[model samples]
Target: MPNQSTNGPSGRPKPECDPIKDEKMGLMREVGGQAVWSLSSCKPGFGVDQLRDNCLETYWQSDGPQPHLVNIQFRRKTTIQDVCIYADYKLDESYTPNRISVRAGNHFHDLQEVELMDLSEPNGWVVIPLKDSNDSPIRAFLIQIAVLSNHQNGRDTHIRQIKVHSPVQNSIVSVLDFPINFTTVQMAQHSTIR
Candidate 1:
């Protein structure tokens, strides 16, 4: 919900790569098995833009449990001191709040307790922070959105675009200034002759 955008040194807007249509989301797409969806699959006359209602739902398999991964890349023109990712999905009474996981570098976090507020309108979106000291330097991040259902009939969930925003980058300096310990060097130097 917070404005993740920040100004760059030159005051130019940070470059953004929002999925315009279903095709664009494909470039950043990852799926489990054969499940898929796109803008073309949507009803005619619906605009394929960065909005909540443009995404389409594909096949819903009742058997075999599996999770999917969706990844997207964009330019960080500024320092990006911090960032938040948002996602929108549809849900019903039978729907259970799925566990959404976010990974930035080696760090992984989870978002839980998600529920649907309105059925007529698209469900609310969740925001997760992507900044952690232990997290690796994130060139890009990957989000795994999934839900587990016990119902005999599986339901397909429609997903809108995932948005990324942050301050722009001005320089190419290392975000962290710290020495990394080399395990090989330590072992060789401290080796004991037996």
Candidate 2:
């Protein structure tokens, strides 16, 4: 049998924790539907699924070297107002991107720099507003990592979360609205939409 105490089981002090690590992980709280970030490529474990996994403790890390691009194709053409980026800058300042360019268009060939961000701060959520084009919201968006802040200690860039805020145009759906004629099986036979 072992002796026990109120402070601890053996009256021993608990080991200290890394505040920076703790601060970097599991830091944001926004309860809603699953995240909507859709990307093309990332590391195996750090894949697109983690980008919107509802947990800030995990992040999607880009693979390979510089000039990493994340292509986002929303299910439908979304009228993007702005985006919220949650990155733990204090923990990984070097690997964090210093300059990011926003490209918005219906097709890949049409992508052009709509907005540029020279991000400086870190460790929390930063809302990057999508540049309104001629007073019109962006239909679809892509994030181009223009410049990466070379971190002496890290190589891969870390992105905790990227949330798109597309305001609801109107919620007044007619009761007469009917479902599409095509079924799941039919859609699957035609193409892999999902």
**How much is 194 displaced in model 1, in angstroms?**
80
Q: Which candidate leads in lDDT?
A: 2
Model 1: how far residue 193 lies from native, Å:
73
lDDT of 1 by residue, 70-108 (tens): 333232212222222232333332322244343333112
- Model 2's TM-score against the true structure: 0.61
- In model 1, the runs with Cα more than 4 Å from the true position are 1-65, 74-97, 106-122, 134-156, 168-194
Give the range of the ten consecutive residues with the poorest summed lDDT in model 1: 113-122
Report, for every candidate in turn, its global Cα lDDT versus the true structure: 0.32, 0.56
RMSD of each: 15.0, 17.6
In candidate 2, where is summed lDDT lowest over 10 consecutive residues? Answer: 1-10
Q: List the residue pairs that clash in candidate 2.
A: 89-123, 94-151
User: CA lDDT of 164 in candidate 1?
Assistant: 40
Residue 64 shift from truth in candidate 1, angstroms: 8.2
What TM value does model 1 have? 0.33
Model 2 scores a C-alpha lDDT of: 0.56
Which candidate has the top score in TM-score?
A: 2
lDDT of 2 by residue, 29-120 (tens): 22213224444457888976776775788887877666556666655666665556667778667667655566777667877776665555
